[model samples]
Target: MTEMVRDNPALARFELGDGDALAVAHYRIADGAMIFTHTEVPRRLRGRGIATRLIAGALDSARARGLRIVPLCSFVVDYLERHPEADDRAD
Candidate 1:
């Protein structure tokens, strides 16, 4: 769908959607790394690939920022397993 995911720095998350339908990938930046801690897609929004797009965009943003990725969230870890091309970015 080419949804435009954006980083909400004040909230420490990569966000997609607006208002009550928001989907987010939460993270913390430290020591040149972006540590992903959680991901959430509204129940109504599940099964529509929203989380995939959100994570992909978040990883891309971290790469652009020259930050390594630390996927602490189970969702992120699973994403890495499913997308081996992203392996190089994770620690």
Candidate 2:
């Protein structure tokens, strides 16, 4: 199933899905950059591409705002590494 990721600026995170299946990519904005600090997925949701969706959504939002990315989170770094198309958006 396709999940919808929502940016909760109040919480400084990009959220995906809901309830028990919810996942999040945590970030902080600084100097026109989105610094991705962490990513989390429920144990039951691992290896299901949920984290990938979350990162993609977060990156898309940053790109839409014309902000660069600082991927401090390991997962986000790896995602960017695998997707060269996103390099333009990264710092």
Candidate 3:
């Protein structure tokens, strides 16, 4: 299973693979508007849908907080493009 946690106020990271193989990191903020700054799923974890999960989690968090989203991160922008339901929260 992927172990993910909000290690900090503006960051959520997930550990993938075994030992130090790779880690996926995403930076996000839920100010008046939700903004996702960065997303990176190491090459080893690339095809595993980790990015999707990260963005979904961020979007869920935004929804819970009743905040609009501004997807500055390319990954998030692309994800939202594919998932139109998420676009409703865009600001």
Candidate 4:
């Protein structure tokens, strides 16, 4: 991904891209927890690990705020399974 992506909680998602090629990792916050809902990357950006970066950034933000993560999205669940040390776990 040529464009650097950042976490944008004001939009309720992490976003990359400026045009129709945009990608997003969407989530919701509830009960002091963050629910990772889904991750979408344009086909052109799919193999570049953009989703992984987005997930990492989002998880990091959640951790900074002391928010527990509820991995509703399969991608997040998979990410957590592979990186247990991330520990953005839900109570």
Relative to the true structure, candidate 1 reaches a TM of 0.91
lDDT of 1 by residue, 1-91 (tens): 5559999999999999845699999999998999999999999889999999999999999888889889999999999899988764544
lDDT accuracy of residue 27 in candidate 3 = 50
Clashes of each: 0, 0, 0, 0
Off by over 4 Å in 3: 2-7, 10-31
Compute each candidate's TM-score over C-alphas: 0.91, 0.91, 0.71, 0.85
Q: What digit string (tens of lDDT, one per residue) describes model 3 on residues 5-61?
A: 233453354333434654444555556776667776767767777678767766776
**Backbone clashes (count) for model 2:** 0
Ranking by lDDT: 1, 2, 4, 3
* Leading candidate by TM-score: 2
What tens-digit string does per-residue lDDT give for candidate 4 at 1-91? 4566677879899787745677788889999998888888889878877778778878888998889999888988998988999977877
Candidate achieving higher lDDT, 1 or 3:
1
lDDT on C-alpha atoms for all candidate structures = 0.89, 0.88, 0.65, 0.83
Candidate 2 achieves a global lDDT of 0.88
- Model 1 residue 4 lDDT? 96
Model 1 off-target regions past 4 Å? 89-91
lDDT (Cα) of model 1: 0.89
Query: What tens digits encode model 2's per-residue C-alpha lDDT throughout 3-81?
Result: 5889999999999974567898999998989999999998888888889988988899999998999988999989989
